[model samples]
Target: MPHYLGIDVGTSAVKAILADERQNAVAEADVSLTVSRLHDLWSEQDPEAWWQAVQTAIEQLRAANASAFADIRGIGLSGQMHGAVLLDENNRPLRPAILWNDGRSFREAQELGAKHPELSHAMGVIPMPGFTAPKLLWVARHEPDIFRAIRKIMLPKDYIRLKLTGAAVTEMSDAAGTWWLDEARRDWSDAALAATDLNRQHMPDLVEGSQPSGMVRSEIAAQWGLQGDVVVAGGAGDAAAGAVGLGAIEDGSAFISLGTSGQLFVTTKEFSPAPEAVVHSFCHAVPGRWFQMAAMLNAASCLAWTASLLKRDIGDLLRETEAAYRSPSNVLFLPYLAGERTPHNDPYARGVFFGLSPATQQTDLVQAVLEGVAFSFADAKQCLEQAGTPLTYAGMIGGGSRSAFWARIFASVLDVPMVRYQGSDKGPAFGAARLARLAATGEAPEAVCTAPSILETIEPQPQLVELYRPRIEAFRNLYRALKPEFVRA
Candidate 1:
């Protein structure tokens, strides 16, 4: 029996899912890694940790005799985007990899926009410090010793792919998030590269995610109890993979993922920047396509914070929402734990309880948190609208989507329908499985999604939408008002 393995490297962990040629999931294993936060909003992870976690997951997956990898056709990769992995002349990591969650790159990001005004204009927006380009610049300025040791720069999954196939390459989907790719043209932007002092030669070769990186090296194959010569497809950025996992294979489909952070991702046919440049535009994993994305710095992060404050399991709390949704909660939560990106471009934004009173119960807080996350999606979708991206409905997936009430609230708040997904709500894993299927059998992603079984289609109630509309307007305004305060505080 031929199978495919889809491996997703995320912020907290590495997950591998086994799928048959038909793209049906059979077995899955995940291993959690750690992120170390230090001074100056820095987030670093030991790259070796990800490698060890992946090896452990593979060993565990190999233990499933019924789901053995003896004849696995291919492996697909999906990982967190924008995190920088600097390598020396021999491709060894120089130091800890700076992660997407790290906020220390703000000054460098501003410097990039200032130094390369024309390039910024061409890209439609200036690069943010949290992005790869600015992070690279930071290394060059502050840690030239580490920077000079660099021969190649790789994204998270790119490094993993290098380990598996002994090849250095990056897929367009992941590269687009680097702030170095000419997202519109689907290639490296020479002008942008020239402006930055960092060397373009340090970057790996670029390829589309669907393309095969190479055969898995014999050593890794033997270590994992698998046959050598298995084709390893370069997977996509998390957003593209997540969208693919939710079956958002074409334009017009949208997905609201409620995970570490919240994001509204819409599939599109071509490059289209938001008018306000509040959103990100990146190439899709499905080839010849793109996506418009709005990501809030906090989503489940907000829920987790609130849950920790009250000492409760988010799931248990969400169960309480069954009754809470019957009547709107009076509290309004601002889901801005790490500031925000979409529609505001302000990283100094912070969370708040705009309307709170003694009458507000735990249920009200939970509802406010859920609705607040949904409010970011509404803002994201509106940003897409400003860019003329069309979205008729939204498919909801991720950790938070497990809450039926939250899913319903997203549908209600956006005035758009939302879905409740069963099985693997982890988008990158399932989507990687689908891509592995394509690599093995050459089937279209859409063809695999033809069998439609929606868990729920929550429609917006007119009165509820009308009432939430004004509140949403206020919610959008609150972030701006609090942004200056976050910077000062």
Candidate 2:
């Protein structure tokens, strides 16, 4: 039987999986990655590191199941979005990739938004520091030498695509996050590109996420012991790939992704722009579809940060916090460790633990950290509602979704049912595999992108929901109270 390979170039790690024709994961591997934060509000990674990680992951996958690896017929890619991977004329990275969480371009983003107010609706959202366009503006202003030499710009996963196929290509879903795509037209917006001092030449060739981008290079195929003519699908950005993983392709289908960053995403058949509400309206991975998303820059990474700071195992801390959870945390946390993106769009905002007392323990802090992330999602949910896509229920997926405790907190805080699917934690890599299958077989999306079997449905407990309501308000008010300080500091 033919197999498909999925590769996710994530912020935290590179994950690759081999899946059989039935979409069952036959083998998988993960290689950890590190981000460099040499300056405040700056997050970057060397693109060469990503290439190395992908190679390592592929090697591990091949070692895990040699037969399945050799039988791979197609590959799909997914990765963190909006990362600026500037390339010189030789297709070499100009510098470390400016990541999605990097907030160095706040002023540039504001200027772009002010100068091109009309482009917001066409581009699907107002320019933000995290988007690729503003990053380019920053480079143009700060690093003129590098900017002048730039011949191409690619998203994180597309950079890997270039390595795999020697083709500079991108798909609609990933392009949509760059603040350069006309969301309604599903193509690059020349006007938007011009505002950033770039034109179509700076961008890679576009393809639909389900379409074949290129064939895997012959040397790569032979080195990995692959079969003949393996096609690479035009894959999605991480969020859209997560949505695809959850089978959220139809109108009104909604899901929450609690990855390094978080997103509350809702699918729509028509283009929906809600930039005023700070919701991202972007193309879905599949053709002729769009999604409205409320994106939060801080999510699971906050938990990981706290765990690393406290020098405790995340699982152990979570269990202790769950045991100690009698009511809402007395302490309120603003999970802006890497700054915020959703409602606030405040890059200066820093993480805070308010209402700490002498009686507070590590467990309380841990609970607060988890609650703070969920509270951000609550803000995201409200933003989605404001954007006219209210969520009654949402499928949940990501590393954080492995914790039932976190899921419970989210369901109560959002006041909606949270559906967890079997192997949901596999997330984007699994979705990429499905896309690979679609690209290889020319299958209908509805037939191949079916939702996995539900593992459990987590519904909000009325009492907890009522309790969380006030806490959620307090969470909002606390942020409001600290807004000035966040800017001043």
lDDT of each: 0.77, 0.94
**For model 1, how does the per-residue alpha-carbon lDDT over 165-265 read when each residue is reduced to its tens digit?**
89998888888888888877777887777666654687778777766778889888877777646888767888888877777867767788877877788
User: Which residue segments of model 2 deviate by more than 4 Å?
Assistant: none
Quality of model 2 by C-alpha lDDT: 0.94
Question: Distance (Å) between predicted and true CA of 428, model 1?
Answer: 0.6
Candidate 2, residues 111-215, lDDT tens digits: the string is 999999999999889999999999999999999999999999999999999999999999999999999999999889999998988999999999999999999
Model 1: what TM-score?
0.94
**In every candidate, how many clashes are there?**
0, 0
Model 1 residue runs over 4 Å out of place are 65-67, 120-125, 443-452
Instruction: Provide the TM-score for each candidate, comma-separated.
Output: 0.94, 0.99
The all-Cα superposition gives candidate 1 an RMSD in Å to the true structure of 2.1
